[model samples]
Target: MARWEIKNVRIAGVAAAVPRNVVYTTDFDFFTLEEAEVFNNTVGIKQRHIAPEDVCASDLCFAAAEQLLADLKWERESVDVLIFESVTGDYKTPPTSCLLQDRLGFSEDCFSMDIPMGCCGCMYAITTGGNLLSSGNAKRALLLVGDTALRMGSMKDKSRVPLFGDCGTAMALEYNPTASDIVVDFHTYGKGYEALMTPHGGFRRPITKESFEYEDFGNGIVRAPLHTLINGMNVFSFAISKPPRSIETFMADYRIDRERDVDYFLIHQANKMIVDRIVKKLKLPLEKVPYNLEEFGNLGGASIPSLMVTRLRKQLMTEEKSLLMSSFGLGLTWGTMWLRTQPMVVSELVIL
Candidate 1:
């Protein structure tokens, strides 16, 4: 792999937006204990937030960007490029990023595009923004991610309904002139596609009322017998093996140790069980892993950024901290990135 030289690129700010409405685990009372037991085994997800029927992924993303820009005190003009990552986009055409850019009042000269890569979306977005900055194509970039897969499912597909939620997160990347300050690495695996996917609703099988009523799969969540198929076991097996292997490989390749080296492990908030599994396998301390799944559930691509923003606002994060972030699952994709924290704001000094 050829290494690219990057100068002073720092994550200037971060923010996340979760829907006001949240669905609790108790909401699953509709499912029998036996059926729910089959679903909850290994893969631990109790509750997830769902966007209102009319709310699109872009809505969550835009709200997140608004809060992020305001918190950073950054003008829209400072953003030269924007990337929106989502599988559940606002539309099939007219990339969601375009709508978001306008909504955020970004300048006309800014370049905007959308990437639809599911769970790996955030990693791809981060890498995209980093390259855009290092290439001098843009001075600063905004990487936004959001998804509402749960709302996209039919009412009958209760299996996936409780696992996904609507959320949006934003990260600001700035170009710096110093070479040693900013560095990054990435890798991906796409062989895991069939292991997880929305079974219907696209060019292959158009939606129809009949499709909605069909129950060939013995489940009501189908348009033409639609089932949000997921091999829970496969996903967990790959997640456990892949994430740790990648992290260890990257650390060894970079010659870094966990003790006195990296400051944080910001894994995607996939679920409590998966998060805990990886944490135990890696033998990483709880403090090293910053998570908020209990409060927000799985926000898909928005998980990592949302956690970062929440921690920062709570004054739980500090300057010059080294954060190691890993993203995995969906498309069977995964990657690890090292970041240095340079907070956008400092504390206020008040007289007693």
Candidate 2:
């Protein structure tokens, strides 16, 4: 149980970017119209925005960062720290954050690095950037998170293809002495790493000609070894068990009332069924938990913030409110955080 209470860090603004290329679950040839309807209703994913072949996660994040910097009117050189979180980078070498720093025209002195994470990427990046500001090491920081997970799924695979979308998000965090503290908790079950992973393409299992060969995993699911492999049952069981308990414990330990203290629960939009299960188990009001999966599918680490920008932009930009967020998936990682916002500038969703 890793927990921290970082103070004096405030979120200044947020922005999200998605590719204009739209893909509908109904268009997938793996399922008939009737099956697609049932799948859409069950997964809550009607369509997704996928990046074009030339657009990488870095490209999307760069676009979002540029927009957010302009919206906040912050000098590019003033951003002292940059953190790019994603499972997919533009290359296997030379951290993507460095590339983004150059492209975004941030000062050469800016501390930039990359964190490779899946669904929990946004929270992890926030935690890292918040601590930097809280410790006086940085006055302002840009936490950019996103993923091109859709490109990793096999078109022939019914289980994983329709559930992913490509997106990037930028969150501005600045040090504010009077700001309320942000509380966070994290847990990892390393044994389940294989439950949701790409079996090849990394050093441990270097990609070979055979890696591209597709094989059937059963129930009409087939994918190449280089593509993502998800043990759906194991992931579902882990999600329902870990995240709820983590949230319950964090709230109790911090004396947080889900009904009163938190205005909304921004959970990682993994899928409709997973969100429904967690909401029911936690006994939270459905109205309080918003969803953008129907429009954007799963944005990996960018899901929560993207949801904040797209679905709760009005509230976030108009009123002061407390938000509780949870993200769990890939790497068997899970985390929860509680923070308060004060009418920050949340930009309109940008489509590339």
Candidate 3:
């Protein structure tokens, strides 16, 4: 079973950062005004934060991490672990987490690693970090997740471009015996891998001159071999089918009562249709489901955490809350995380 409870892993705080530049749906050059309106209403993505040419996912995470560490009033060396999750890394060679560890000035002995899972990243990284602290090997851990997803899409591809935005998030966890346990369950469907992926740039399919040529794939999706391509129908069918079953399994397996046990449910911001469908299928209250995907496009793994910083910021900062977080998308992986958060520091939304 890919389901278990991690004990005594307390959520200490969270912080997030997004690019300063804004691209309103109507202003997106790829979409005509009428098409843009349809996209905004249908997908519920009103604006996107496009990162500048020089900035990378690591840079965004660094800014968020730096601010969070300060707000939490923790010294650099006191941190014991750092987990970074992103697909758009600094390089394909050196893991970006290594660069962040040095850049963040953590202790030389701090455990650091990289997680490149796509949309399920936040929970996966958090669960990994939480397990590390729960094992008594570490006292405090940092989980950083983000994606410059816009960088992966072809600008001219209407389906790809408007559906992505850039964001980085930092979550701090601590070992506290009395704190509530963080329950997490993850499931993977490797068979659906090609449903959303870049077919080149990896060792198996090294990039060549032809990798740069964008091909019109019959629909609005046009992309190079090096760029990520999503089979929308495949992804949509999987999204609508798998996640609902997964959520039901969690609720049954874990004895979760949505009305009684949870304060909020933050599912992946894949789009408004997917979100609304899952919510309706699960019978989750729309009021209790907090979604801010419209403010920033589908942020891959960072979507849920981004919500904690933006939509539910004041409430979370002022009071204790229990949240059910799930993200299902790219990589064909998804996870459900139940977090009991105390009144914690949530940094102001950073515009980098």
Among these predictions, the greatest TM-score belongs to 2
lDDT of 3 by residue, 230-303 (tens): 88889989988888888888888878899988999989899999999999899999999988889998999899
Total clashing pairs for each candidate: 4, 0, 0
Which candidate wins on lDDT? 2
Model 2 misplaced stretches (Cα beyond 4 Å): none
Which prediction has more favorable TM-score, 1 or 3? Answer: 3
Clashing pairs in 2: none
Query: What 10-residue stretch in candidate 2 is worst by lDDT?
Result: 150-159
Per-residue lDDT of candidate 2, residues 113-190 (tens digit): 899988999999989999999977789999999999977878788788889999999999999998999999999999
Q: What is the lDDT of candidate 2?
A: 0.92
- TM-scores for the candidates: 0.87, 0.98, 0.98
Q: What RMSD value applies to candidate 3?
A: 1.0
Candidate-wise lDDT, in order? 0.72, 0.92, 0.89
Two-way lDDT contest, 1 vs 2, winner: 2
